[model samples]
Target: QLLDIARKYPDFPIVLETVRECLQDVYDVPALTELMRRVAQRRLRVVEVETATPSPFAASLLFGYVGAFMYEGDSPLAERRAAALALDTVLLSELLGRVELRELLDPAVIASTSAQLQHLTEERAARDAEAVADLLRMLGPLTEAEIAARATTDAIGGWLEGLRAAKRALPVTYAGQTWWAAVEDIGLLRDGVGAPVPVGVPAAFTESVDDPLGDLIGRYARTHGPFTTTEMAARFGLGLRVTADVLGRMAVDGRLVRGEFIDDLPGDQWCDAEVLRILRRRSLAALRAQVEPVSTAAYGRFLSSWQHVGSSDSTGIDGLAAVIGQLAGVLIPASALESLVLGQRVRDYQPSMLDELLASGEVMWSGAGQIGGSDGWVALHLAETAPLTLPAPAEIEFTDTHRAIMETLGHGGAYFFRQLTEQASESELKTALWELIWAGWITGDTFAPVRAMLSGPRRSGAPAHRQRQRPPRLSRYSVARPHSRAADPMVSGRWSALPAAEPDSTVRAHFQAELLLNRHGVLTKGAAAAEGVPGGFATLYKVLSAFEDAGRCQRGYFVESLGGAQFAAASTVDRLRSYLDGVDPQRPEYHAVVLAATDPANPYGAALAWPDRAGDADTHRPGRKAGALVALVDGRLVWFLERGGKTLLSFTSDAETQRAAAAALADLVSAGRLPSLLVERINGVAVLDPGVDAERAAVQEALTGAGFARTPRGLRLR
Candidate 1:
């Protein structure tokens, strides 16, 4: 009955509006039908839960609304909002194309949408001369025929005459057409003359008599990118010159920005201020997404070659410094750093070159990890950024002797051992010096501390047989003076401590992440953890992700099995792609490069885990320790020599590969990587395990052929 009343009395606003409010806006019939269909077909389920009291949503439905958003509905702020909403209704009563850009780049779709919106704007505009004048004010510049057609009347010519005589409108020649615009907009429309004309729009007139196009046009501009006056006019079904004028007014009012927006389009264009920011952000995102993923094997081999392992591509002291920068914050033994790590990278990495960098203060070393016995492992850092890169100091036990040495050095000058001994005995001072060094407080002017730190019972690369060959000194056992021994190579360099760094954690984290990328072309949580990076990959992850957002680097699944959580500098990704594995299989030729088991480039036990021992009962497994060695044959781990350099573990069962692995160990000794290697066991068994042709005979034979002497206990390299 109410529906019948509403239909009969169309003039009664309450009845029809109530029906629309309930069925059209409040309760959507189509959605309700879809929900019912889903329930009926069992595609969705419905359940009822009885609560102790009415639920929040149920109470809302029962009371309709609890209160207004503000304290009162009649407040001044509320009154202003209500006024704005009322004005918005008239402005949006006939909206143009949707703000969402569906056909932003497609010309055909844009054109069709343009025509439909133009026709809609014309057809919906009010039908009168004052309304035409307002259109000129809002979206104007129309010929007489255009105004007449838009107004759907033949009397538009008469309206033009009235407007012209009243001096309310002016004419302008634009796009080879004389179009009339409101007199006030001449500054933005271009120079004008005496003229009057009009055309008609479609027949869907709006109820409003006082239409303001400023707010309407401003809202429309936010939906798309840069557009010219002609393009916007055609799309909106308004006068081109008038559209440009309105756009210009908005630009002057700081609501819009004018420029040559679209690169290919030839003309000045205007875009919404916020819209330009959106466009720039989207462009950066598109560019950052252009990286390609590569396989783990390829990335591993690429890293090996990139760090100059097994390759002699570096030269001079500058090259040595670059390698040190790459190795910053990486903790490795001082001994292996020169013999194995740096030597593996630079072509002719002489000790003299490193001494030069240390002497020049271009590179600095600070003890980091508590890896090697009492002295610990050290991390190399660039002299400039060393303060920023230094990790938080760890607590250490300082003795009186240590305090005396530090006090003497704290006087601000480097001191040799003999000088510091004036305050303490030589033995006491030497022990105290290393304690301070391991505490990360002191360093030597030369590399002597590194040598002294290695001077423990765990001998360096000095051949055991050569030690016995040294003839006994015939000189008297008299008190030695500090004469020519001033430049002693052992431990006589001047010792001084670096001021403790009080770093900003955030700044330090960002810097560490950048250096991490510089060290490893591709960074992964496992690899970062392997290096024992402070706070682990979790801390660096935030900075790296930020780098990606800023387009400084890329984040992607660059290596298989390393997880999708990976980040790399842009150049790193380029180099990784330039040598994809399958693209040219034989290019990075297979050479057995031996790396300290703890070297970051070893990849095994870092990016990749160690293979299971050959026998389940085997007690020892491969680990990344200071004194151990790993040999990679084309980025595949085939040998793991334990830190003691006695027990050898083989990852492969191939006889020839076994020989290759042992031969590589021999080559390591030949390259001065080790004084000698004594292999007593292979894969948890004796090298010649019991039988004439032992189970691990191949390794024994290979070691012997590589100049290893057969000692009573094992195969020893001389």
Candidate 2:
């Protein structure tokens, strides 16, 4: 009967029992929010009433199913879905009633609900955009179905239609389905197909709306005027072929003008003819203004601002002091400071001023990075650097590189490595300083501390002019004394210290062997053979014999009956001792065997009887094969001979990982991790080719033949 009544008249009041029953299924926040939003849109109305059977009446108007009024004359309920969604309204409505209608309809509540809807909408949009971008990069061109499959939202059809309407992506009819592609890829596809180039702007809209092409061109010229057809296509989200054709027509019609070709821009540009004419007029006026002379008072002001020295001053002695005074305690780029002091009238201004100031102990310069710059310079006032007392007379022999460094730093300013790089070749500077550093005259922490000029406190009695005349100087070194000879234990080879401590070849082999054994108790023949250095397998065999002599380790060929539990139960120390016996000190593997046996866990601790590895110990030479390929994996250098015959996979050219590979290599190269020699040895670098198919056997064969190999992470060259 209730169904019949509801069917007969829409908006009929749904009884509290029926309303609660329907709502009982929806307990989630998302579902309730969606329900409330629908109600707010008037898809349904929430209502309440006073009734005895149900007590406090809570009912809803089922607009789609029934009428608000009944044939039996039931009272109509007020619309209040928003209030119910946010909070229980029965108590508030009864307590306040119409007295607080304004509070009930507060803007804050309305905005809060709207904002949630907006946030969900934006998140969906961003996800869809990312999915579309990924699909285009991986597949080159994709049909609507492919995009929908990857999209995050269910309304893919509507979202795609919206994107099309907004001209954010292009669509083409291919193989009977609409194929979508990124705007930039459209140009590549047309070129790849070898389409005949249009002779001129193919008659723009002769059969369509009035001068739509002309209007678009005019608008583009007005905003991004003097832009090429490629740039226009990208900005407007149109195909380059069509955009170029239309632009050509506008040029023929004298409605558009072409601009000079720029190497960086990669093409000729177009502008509305009127815009071109306006630009030409402006350029001509600017030229005229350049030739015009300023009044004497204006000239005087410029000279005063620059504190210009006389032309016959010859040397920068006068100019240097004046420039320092103008700059005061501030640190500024050498170029900017030079330009300000010398104006356009001087050439070779920076080097000239540097010589004068540094010789006079009036200024300092700093490089970028931890140390400071090779090309760029940061100037510091000598007044800001603390005075240093003279040391006992000692020979101070200086190389050209050393002199250049002093001139760069001047009296005592911080500089970056690149700034130092500007004074001399990075390698030369490193080489020249190697001796001084090794001798302990200089330390690894060579870069000066970065200090900025801070404003001084206001004084009650001192004159402002006097304070300005005597600014405080910051000291580069807190204490000027060099460490005493007794302080350094390794003073014999001072001035030629090696770069860093490297493990002995024997010790390193022992460490790697131990790690392998711990991870896998029994090393297979192939695993032992695959060690990076040649003859490592024989060294392991010798070490096993010595362990046997010491009764700390065991060594023998694997037997079928030796189960996994047997290996696990055998103590590593007992095995090592049994394995290290009968090793000769004169043999090549003696050091390796001895090193492995001396592990604290093993009882052969007395095997070495050597001092702890020193910081400047003689370097160990590993028997690595020549021409070995070195590649960085997870920021550590790993040598790879071949790809183990696995098929190579290629990712999209624009994939984040692929793009970041070059940057990673550059970073490693800069950090001195990858030597310059190894960078040159990279025989066949992999090029990112997104359009190529990886599954093709012929493609794989060709890549392999050319020394290229692919891994899941990226492509590599052997």
Candidate 3:
């Protein structure tokens, strides 16, 4: 059977032997001895036994028994040898006792015993099975028994069974009810059995009373290595009072090296090799992570004590110093140190506590007194700590004109010329110079000459023939004369070439009409006729002159009837139109527009009228008569129809139009699709849209829909 079992599992070890006694007998000594010998041989161990009767030769032969007869007799040396050999036998026996022998015995009895054992085990497992069944029933109907079996076989099942047995056997009663009943009522059965109650004193009290002197000694030696009591106490968490006694005992026992108490060691003082190696290998990041959570006050106390023990002489200490110095520099700049001191009633620092640090030159004074000589003033060099640099100027993209100016400046260094000319024409030079000055590229003081040349008074009283003739040139004899002074020719020649002024009654009448129009806003035909103004001549000539001098007007006019400079006019019209387009009246700019519109007879409206007002009287007339002005009443609806397919007014220009427009605007505002009127701007004019109230209503509705509450002014999201 053993061979079959070993063959079945080829990796398993097997042993076999023959015995003189009947194999089936339970207590056959010879057979047992043979079996034990085979067991020892297979396991590679020695076995020994002592004989009652002794013969030297027989004993030697007995000791030579290869399988079942190994033995020793009581001789003085033999007893010692027997004891030595028996130790292995005893150890093997103890090991073999731990292994169960039932599987190796008769199968019928084994099967019967196992069945009985399984019955008991099943009885123990039944409560667990019930719990699993209950849990499965709660979840859903079982899909299969095999799946349910897995839950029953889990550690929780074992725990549940144990708990059930414990509760049944030991029913602990508290407060007039069984503890088990309370546990079930509270659903504590889900987690399994409660811990067993401890007898005698509590473990916490016992552990506290038991001195951990050995552990403390070991930890102290490891952390403070080769240190005396004073140094050890200062460095470690152990209090100084008790540390000296422990250290003295440890020194007497030769566990520590006794030494003279020199608290401050030199920089090169040796420590335990292991400690030095650990310090060398410790990473900065790891140390920072460990120490960062330690409060600054606690760290300061530790550092103060550590300095006293001469631990600050290492490179790690130097690194820490540098870190602290840098931190102080940063924090001092950000924090108001004087204010903190004045505000808080902090404890005064102890002089004795800081004595070691001061004496060892680890601490230094950093206040104004440290500066010395000039009132001991200490000034921080901000530049040394944090430097600032100005941002470089952004490069600007240049146009062709800008590039030309740059090139001209580069060549000319600085120009003194009143005008820059592309060509030598006086008009071109004046135009270019004016453009440059306007664009801020060139500057000059003398604009009078250019201005006069462009628009100036003409000379009068010269005959037509004389005006037409060119000025005379200087004689060669006069130029060749040694000291003959001549009138400044350039000035004389320019003055001579000036054109004579024309004095006509027609011109005078045109000027007079223009002056009147400039002074007053009226241009009545009756007044003109009363002044004997020819029907077409004065008006046509005046209009032409006005057109010529249009560029000189401070407040320029645009003929909206002629669309050349329509932007400014269009903007003004659009601003007024937008305001009338249901703009919020509460907005400052919108209110201004509303006030302007309310006047009805404002002169500014007439000024804004188109020049060809007679042709399209309804469209171009000012005030309510103008089509644009009337459109303002329903402009919101009109704009909506024009801008998008949506209709602001359902009823087209009827009694319902206003109501429909208001409803649509209110809906839009509610939908959050429209901005508040107070903040809206149109055509450089800020106007609140009338839809703002509607928009607020819409926002409130949305917020309420999204599970919020609305107050009078706004909605609260929460």
* lDDT (tens digit, per residue) of candidate 1 on 167-206: 7776656555777867655443332221222222112221
Model 2 Cα lDDT, one tens digit per residue, 1-718: 3333345446434445444654575555455455444443454544666555532332232431243232112210111312222443334434754222222233333333333322323443336665566455544556666565555666677666665665555675433345676554444444433222222212331123355445545554643335678777764456788788888887777676664412345675665656444443443343333223222222222222223222334344565555444433232333233333333223235444554564454554332112122222233334332111101112357788866654654444444444543667755775445333322222222112211111122234567676545335586655578543221111111121112212354654554445334433444333344322235566765554444433433343222222211111134322322322222423311110000110111111111112222232233111121212222122111222211212222222222222233343334334332232112111122334444433233333433443445555344443
| Candidate 3 residue 400 C-alpha distance from true site, Å | 17
Error of 1 at 207 (Å): 80
Q: Write the per-residue lDDT of candidate 3 for residues 1-718, one digit (tens) a residue.
A: 3333234444423332232122355365555555544554556323344559855767766645631222122112222332333333224435753222112222333233333322223442334545544433232112223223434353453544454454421223222233222122222211112223323323332223123443344433543323445554433345656666665565455454332212344221122324322322332222222222222222222222222211233233333333223222111200112111101111222223222332333432122111111111111111122111111112344545444444555554344332222434433443443344333233222212222332233343478776656437665444455543333211111100001122454564555454333311222232233223444335634554453333212112222222222112122222222222122433312110011111111222222231122232232223311111111122221111111111111112332333333344333335333322121221112123344444333432332443434333333222
Global fold similarity of model 2 (TM-score): 0.18
Report how far residue 573 has shifted in candidate 2, in Å. 87
For candidate 2, the C-alpha RMSD (Å) to the true structure equals: 33.0
By lDDT, the candidates rank as 1, 2, 3
- How many steric overlaps does candidate 3 have? 9
Deviating ranges (above 4 Å) for candidate 1: 1-293, 369-375, 418-422, 452-490, 582-589, 691-698, 701-709
Predict model 1's lDDT versus the native: 0.66
| Count of backbone clashes, every candidate in sequence | 24, 61, 9
Candidate 2 displacement at residue 576 in angstroms: 84
Model 3 ranges with Cα > 4 A deviation: 1-204, 207-237, 240-411, 417-430, 434-687, 693-718
Over 4 Å off in model 2, which ranges?
1-207, 222-224, 261-266, 305-718
